[model samples]
Target: MSATVSPDQLPLQRLYHWERTAPNRVAFTQPVGGGQTVDYTWKQVVDQARRMAAHLQAQGIGAGDKVAMLSKNTAHWMMTDYAIWMAGAISVPLYPTLAAGTIRQILEHSEAKLLFVGKLDGWLGMKPGIPEGLPCIHHPLAEADAKKSYPGWDDIVAKTAPLAGEPVRPADDLSTIMYTSGTTGAPKGVMHTFANFMAAVAAGLERIPQNEGSRMLSYLPLSHVVERALVEHGQLQTGMHVYFAESLDTFTTDMQRARPTVFFSVPRLWVKFQQAVNHKMPQKKLDTFLKIPILSGIVKKKILSTLGLDQCIFAAGGAAPMPAELLAWYSKLGLNIAEGYGMTENIGASHITTGDPDSFGTVGRPYAPVQCRIAPDNGEIQVKAPWNMLGYYKQPELSAEMFTDDGWLKTGDKGSTDAQGRLKITGRVKDLFKTSKGKYVAPAPIEDKLVMHNAVEACCVTGANLGQPLALLMINAEATAVVKNGGKAELEASLAEHLKHINETLDPHEQLDCLVITSEAWTVDNDLITPTFKVKRNRIEDMFAKNYDRWVGMRKPVVWHG
Candidate 1:
């Protein structure tokens, strides 16, 4: 009766079956250098994964071995992932953009033996990294810098036997050790089994109509569990077309070409996509046009084309809070953009907003298999599910703190349930900040409202003793990249308008008293954001502490220090 095979088989076993069933069908379509996406069939991918599995076993990687991967989102990345499980070793995924110190902490924490590096920017050379003989993998000469020397990925895969005996992979065996980013302290490794991965795939497919015929465009990093469980496992079962964005710059053009029926994105990217539509026809113009009723359809159609959400039915937003305003705006354009909430500890698939219109603001109800409860004392969300992680890899003290004695996984997010039982995440219990007056301000909800503004690409909310509500905002690079050669004045005016709009939408206390604009991007490396792309509040505040007064003196509605 289940959608998957016997629970006794490993995920790699399921993958081998899909290859036989749909041999020539496309498995993953990765991006090439200049505006091109390439495809690999299911059979070819499986054969390579098996060969890689064979090669890994030859290198002494068998059951219980932990193989760590630090790579960007690519076909080779996911293929190597299956190879690890196929060989019965646990997969340890490291965020490609993590700081060297953080990477060192995680690899050391997980006690990873082998690390495969796909392609990295300059930061890969930083010290205290994965040591030599760990077998670092890199892309061909294209992503490599001649000056920067490291082990090549091709040489290792080449050394692997093209064929080998079947590995003893079991369903209950540990499949991955996913390290979750900590809000208050160091990260922890969350262990998940092969059955957890497959069950999540089955449960997720119940929400959307995904199959071999359905196409998926994966923009999120493969390291994240939700992306991996859905895009990676679903492809093995369905022989679906999986296309990667050419580059972050050409993601929009890539979306249009892929014309994906099933798509997933983080809440931050979802907000920017909605804002892009608003910039084309400012809110005033849209309101005025909607009043006409006649021109509204035409105007909305044009706007949808610009945002490239013209034909996507299975669009989802996760990892952070999504504003009610932006969700309604896209819903009007006939997009099925729904909001969901989850943490890495749960294999990253949890409560999700349903396709039904009534399920709007709520993260919808929990999946049938997942039982969630609001804890009595501090309102921490707790999950009791079969797919829940076993414990932290080696930290018993941390692991004991994560669960109740009765077996509930304590999620630090604060939430409440509506009458219909749909879950609404009020805020994060840990992310709530105390003002100088000791008034608690939850930044997640406030940050959600501010990012709805078009020119505001990313923002972090912070205020210590002296400063009023200050937000460090990064301008939308894609929009500014095309302010054409000499359009600095126009870009400034647009950014000014965006700051004004965001300020007007907030309550008096929650209003951003000052805005810090910077051209330098906020990413995991610079320590401004997390692996899941959430802002690092402490780092942002420290970075701007000296220049905080200069922004307030500008007399502008917001600060522009770039």
Candidate 2:
């Protein structure tokens, strides 16, 4: 990777370059008119972005001002992001799934001067969260938010002329202030500069092969660093065509339409895809068919096409650890899901699998010019990279604590490097629990193992001060429905057998003493899981803390029906 990058390498400059070099090349595709779609060329994207930038400038929102974007992933969201940077402002993104309280806190904390609302599912419900005095701009596709008397997209574009200028930002200029999802604690504002994003995009492109004409589907929240880097910055750098998912109902259809060469998703979605396949064809039967020569080839093609992954060159799972069993299952069907590791602090630059079968269960080696080490005392992973964040916004003390005296950013995840430099994440350093027997247990790896069972949807291992660790199991909806019928006894028996199998493979200290089955579902709305679908261990522990003693004292291998 290049040690020194010019301003021309930044996203805004790349957008202008693409417009001049490939004016008519399709830049984005948005679903519209129910099932139809609309395409935006490179020229169109640049023109609209410039128009929006001019509008912002007319509104006295310029250089160093903060602008917030609240919406689901959409074409307008990308356009507005570019406009904010083009207007010499910082973009602040809020997840569409965020609660009203969170929205208010972020807006007030970032001191945003304007908000661009677009393509949200629950805009009416979230309306109460928006500050009364703040001004708003509605995207063309934001029907729900359009019901209010906010400035509309067409009005802004029609009344303002395109901003006329070359790139105005230096490499160190702040581009965005991204709020971290508060899984463990209150969210912090992570600031990333133009240089940081450029460095990360350049480093990532060196490892992951993407170029002009490469296609990607943008369904994940653009707010997250992973999607922002890969879809937004990656598109600008590589001139890739991006497609937007209209809704959850149309995700499969949209994926089929784009036929993206590179696809990415969280582990939770991958699990749901796996379950969908297994529901159609029993695992045993699928395994038997895959053992046959010609039939195996046909089965693999059919499965990939059915899931709209037939054209996928690189598929990734991140934001949480993916089970080794899940990886192997996909590998058998010719889809190698590369597991990666990174955090918002680093602009999602850390480790990624080599797409090799042997690289399974490990987030592979660091990118070029990036260095990583495990802290000796607590086994916490630490990294030093050009793409690391400038600092937490307005939190000097916290920012200082995030890095070592020598400047290596301290990642709170506990992990160790293999002989080949692959990273094996154990768990969060703060999430480690100590049993009454004085043994420390990392629940993440064990929980990953438990969820491999077909009946399990989510699992949490907690016994911070108890004699032995206990597993809280949330059954999948389909499995729960089965249990509701006459399958209750049978499902309990099977879960017990599965628990015994899992415990046999674990160390005695790490073994789960009992399993508590609950029918209640954990979701982002309920605070049991983060927006990225990672289970909040602390929240789960707190929810069942009062019953932990009794559950452990039962002295039974399976404490069924909680």
Candidate 3:
């Protein structure tokens, strides 16, 4: 990392740089359906943001005021965030899929002065959470009813004069309050300064190396810390051309259009991509093709092209543990997926894999100037970084608990460092469960192995007081459809074989009692998984703990649950 970073490298400062240096360069490309797209030049992006900043200031949103954003990733979503900062306000972003109660909790807790609504699929369900009389500005991509109800972005920009001159914010000023997509409990607002954001991006760029010619596709929820730091701040730093996905149905088209030089996604999406490829070309057939010397290169190229990652120079997976098997699979296909480790607390800069075969399963060395260690007492991973959060907003007691007597942030993840200083996370301290036999098992590792099977989408391994742990598996949509069509016998036989293979690798106590194939899907709507696709263990317990004994006592290797 650079020893001294100029204040000029701050997000707003970088935006100003691009606006002046390359006013005509395309900054954002937005899909508008029907095979059409709209491009926003740097000048256009800055102009709209400037006018919106003036509008926000006119409404008394200045000097640390909190402005909330509720939307999916869109060009205007980034624009609105810039506008909030220009108004001397702290931006608070909400995940677009948040339920009404959680939505209301965050808005009321942050005491947001205003809200920006954009590109939401569930506005009607989420609208009840917004307190009446709170001012809102709608992005053009917002829901139809929301557009009719709130002041539109174009309308406000048209009426307001652009703020003149280069208004500067101090480096230490609060920039954004990112609420965690809580997997266990209520969301906590993670506060970050402008300098924190800049430091994280700088450390990242020191290794990843993006420039003006870099292209990125923004589809991950920008509300997440990884996306906020990598895509939004990365673009601001390097003048990357960002493309937005119009919808899930058109994601492939959007990816082909962007041909992003840099791409990041969670493990679930990576698994889905592999599943899609296997659906088209069975893994057995693909493997056989790759063994032929002449056809190997051609086969790899065709597969990457089909997945729209043929031009991707850097691809990463984070926000959860990526299965080593999955990484090896992509490695064979000529795409090396770097696994990164970070949390909302660290501004998503801690460690990343170095693309070394020796560092395959470990998150490679920590970024420069970031210190990482395992706690002597509980084995929790603790980190001290320039970009660590100020603390959880307005929760002084909880914030105090998040750190040690010194300043290291307690990451809650149990991990160890290798001889080369790479990190290998074992499990969450709180995620370990002791069974009736008094042997504690970390479910994440076992669940990682189970999810490698094609039929499983998401899973949870839990027992608590039972004799042994058991797994609750949610078969993926395609497999579920096949089961509904009466292919249960074959699916059951396949899962039983997979279960036997997995258990053979484990000690008797650590082996699962049974694999219960769940009837219901685990989704955000059902409160069984976070928006980032991490399974909620507590929710899984609430829904299935009552049946643990029955599941284990069934005396079958695989049990089908209704």
Candidate 4:
């Protein structure tokens, strides 16, 4: 008795089924110039995908050929993905935030025969990364990049007829080759098939409730597996109406317009949201207001509505571990931000937190037919699921090493299971560092605790070969501005107190020796964070390795400045 759907019920087939059954139903609502939005029906999606598929076929791109898409999230992005598959080609997605070098590497490594550019913020900078011989197609939204003399996407759609019939692909046929945004090391392309996607979509739908009228806001890069599973595939499965965020500036207004019934976000964005609420209503004052039963309901409703999460039936946080304190705080507002655990290799399928209060800190039990177990030796979590990727594309040796002889995909994450079978991730196996005292320190939990402080925007704990670990902290922009305006001493003292509080709760070995407050913020532009918002631990270590000895030797509880 499993909830998993058969491969025959794949997303592409489901798309066609919905097109036939609900052709007029709104499939996507995309924002255009000005403050306007455009709606596309299921029929429109199929029509566009069909025409695009025909165009690809006309260009001699056939089955097994690789097609790459570099773009931000948009209706066209999803349509292009479908068209690639419909044309019997493998789709390769590149994150819009990637630098030209990484972009070039992925495109070359994947052997992409054709490239589609759409709605990118950095297309001008990334244009040089396109391999010279590869043909390019520019979406209408990519007008800036389109000036380079590539054929327009609209031109293809207008000139080509719709594909006569959907191309047949076996369940095991490769659907997409997704490159991992390497936080620890070099990126590797993870290959997933139509069957893998179907399995993930089926398991995810069973765990998270969704139906025809469900709404989702798609802002996270569709290149990521979580957005693909939850937003794209979720749309196909449930006939959900999707709304795309126009840009970072319009995210709030867009969220309000969508009023999404199911919302998902990474932990960094969730932390910012919490910090914003705290700025408006100080934590102490909010706590006092919540004590009044009548006022509590009003405060909660007002806060949720303003954040445009008032209609959210399910709110999930993933791509990184969420701080337990943040989860508790959201719970007080009657919005439980459940944490889920997965990686690109598994098509983002694994554990998800139950809405129950007791399950707050742990990623809940495995989804149906997905097995999870911790390695007895190093505590790495291993998974066996129908949704797991076939292997790392073009790296047979690396692929072979990803699984045990018995076939569980080695997740490379360190975690443990509770009595209720809930999984609590400690850190990545490669992320654990050893102190001079020979004790191993897992930075994730400690970093989570440090980021709970409102002033601390991002944090990394590293002290390899030192007496104890030290936290490299970045102050929030607002907090830094306050310090610049004569609040320096107060901010330092507050940070010191925060460090002491965090240290007291940690094990002796895990306690941070000092907090090094970094001047420059870590960001994707600077290569300090991945596109998915996970901190690049390797880069941080490289930047501070020389200063680590000096910082730890200072023997102060907090460095105040670095």
**Top TM-score model:** 3
lDDT of each: 0.73, 0.88, 0.91, 0.89
Clashing pairs in 3: none
As for lDDT, the candidate ahead, 2 or 4, is 4
RMSD of each: 3.8, 1.7, 1.3, 1.7
RMSD of 3: 1.3
Q: Note the residue pairs that clash in candidate 2.
A: none
Regions more than 4 Å wrong, model 3: 1-4
Give the TM-score comparing model 1 with the true structure, all chains together.
0.87
List candidate 1 segments past 4 Å from native.
1-5, 8-10, 35-37, 123-128, 139-142, 145-160, 164-168, 286-308, 355-357, 464-468, 478-512, 518-520, 545-557
Model 2 ranges with Cα > 4 A deviation? 1-3, 554-562
Q: Candidate 4, TM-score vs. the true structure?
A: 0.97
Candidate 3 at 524: error in angstroms? Answer: 1.2
What does candidate 1's lDDT look like per residue over 129-224, in tens digits?
765455655544225442245555566566665555445465667888887765445777888887777777777778767877888887677788
Over the full model, what C-alpha lDDT does candidate 1 score relative to the true structure?
A: 0.73
Q: Which candidate wins on lDDT? A: 3
Q: Per-residue lDDT tens digits of candidate 4, residues 237-335?
A: 889899999999998899999999999999889999999899999999999999999999999999999999999999999999988888999999999
Q: What is the lDDT of residue 18 in candidate 3?
A: 93
Candidate 3 or 1, higher TM-score: 3
TM-score of each: 0.87, 0.97, 0.98, 0.97
